[model samples]
Target: MAAPTAWIVAAAPLAAALSALAAAFVTGFDQRSAMPPDLAARFYGFFLDRYPLFAFAIPYGVARLLAVALAPGRSGALRRVIGAALGLGLLLGLSLHPTFGGMVLRAGFGTGSGAFLNGTPMAAAYAFGAAAAAGLFGSALGLGAALIGRPGTPRPGSRRRRAGRAILHALAGFLALWFAAALIGLAHDAGFGPWPRRPLDARDAAIAAGLLTAGALPHLLLVAARLRRATRAA
Candidate 1:
C-alpha cells in the first residue's frame, strides 16, 4: 500500500478509539447511592469489563483485524461478505438514534436509566422496534454509500473521483462504529435483574451509539482496500 493508503488504514482505528473515549467521557456518571449495592456492583463490573472491550477493543480492534485477514489479495467474495456485515452494523446503529436520543426506550435523552434494565418481553420488543425505525432513513444513505464505494470500481487519478471515494469510505467507517456499539447495550443488559434508577443523560447515549459505529469501520475499509488491490492486480 502507498503512504496515503496506509494513513487511511491507520485513521480508522484512531478515529474509533477517539470517539469511544469521547463518548465514555460524556457518559461518565457517579451514582453509587442511586441504586442497590449489588446492582451498582454489577453496573461497575460491566463498566470495567464489557464496556471497555465492546466500546474500544472488540468491535473496532477485533473487527478490523478480522477484515484485514479475511480480505487478502484479490478476494472479492470475502470483501463483499464484509461489506454486508458492515451494512448490517450500519442499520443496527441507525435504530439506536431514538433509543438514547429520547425517542425509543426512554422518553428523553437525559432521562432515567431504568428503562434499559426492564426484563419484560414487551419492553424489549417496543425498544427494538423503535430503535430500528429511528435508523431507517440513515440506513438508506449508508446502503447507497456502500454500493457507490464498491472497491476497485473507482479510478485512481481523478480528483473528483478520489474525493467521492473518500466520502464513501467515511460513511462505511461511520456505520461500522454504530454496529460495534450494540455491545454497549449488551453491557447494560448484563445481570438482567432490575434495580433503582437514575438519569442516564446524553453522555452515555452518544457513547453507546459511537462505540458501535467505530467497531465496524475497520472491517468495512479493509475489505474495500483488499478488493481495490485485487482489482489493480487483475
Candidate 2:
C-alpha cells in the first residue's frame, strides 16, 4: 500500500522531466518553421499544434495519476501537498498559453480603435486549458478528502467527517483558481503581442501524452487499491 504512494511520488520528477522534454520539442518545432516563409501566415501554428501535449497532457495526467496512487493511508500531509502543487501548477500552466495570452494582449494593446487582429486559436488552446483545469480540479478533491479523512485506526464509535465535503472544497478551489487565471491571462494579453507565440508541434503532442500516461496511470491504480481496501474493511 505504502509502496504505491512511494511509486507515485517517485514519478513526479519523472513527469516534470518529461513535461520539460515535451516543451522543448514544441519549441524546437516552432524554431524550425519560424523562417520557412511559406508557412508564415500560420504565425501561431507552432503553438497550436503542441500546446495540448505539453501544457495539458503531460502535467495533468502525471498529477492525477499521482493523486490516485497516493491515496491517503498514513502519510496524508505529503499527499495533500503533491495534490495541491499539481492543481495550482495546472491552473497556472493552462492560462499561460500563447493563444490565451495573445488574446489578453490584443484586448489591451491594439490601436486605440483596436487595430490588433489577434484572436484565440480556439481548438488547441482552450482544449488544453480545459483538460489541465479538469486534472487540477480532480486532484484538489481527492487530496482534500485525504486531509480531513479519518485515521484508519480510529477509536471505537467514531464518525468519519464527510469525505464528500472535503472533495467538494478541493474541487471548488481548483475551479476558482483556474477561472481566475484564465481571466487574468485574458487581461494580460489585452495589455501586452503577448509576443512570440510558442507554437506546439507534433513531437510535443506525442511526448506530452506519453508523459501524462506514464505519470498518471500508476497513481490511478493506487487510488483503486485504496478504495478496495476500504470496501474490504467495511
Using TM-score, give the best candidate's number.
Answer: 1
Number of the top-ranking candidate, with lDDT as the measure? 1
For candidate 1, write residues 1-234 as lDDT tens digits: 443544454455445555655554465434544667754554443233323333344234433333333332334665556665665455334423332221222221112233454554654543453344224423433463353234233456689877886677656654544444343445355332111133234554454445444544554465456455645644
Backbone clash total for model 2 is 14
Q: Number of clashing pairs, model 1? A: 17
Candidate 1 lDDT: 0.43
TM-score to native of every candidate shown: 0.32, 0.31
Displacement of residue 120 (Cα, Å) in model 1 is 11
lDDT of 1 at 23: 57
- Give me the overall lDDT of model 2: 0.42
lDDT of 1 at 232: 64
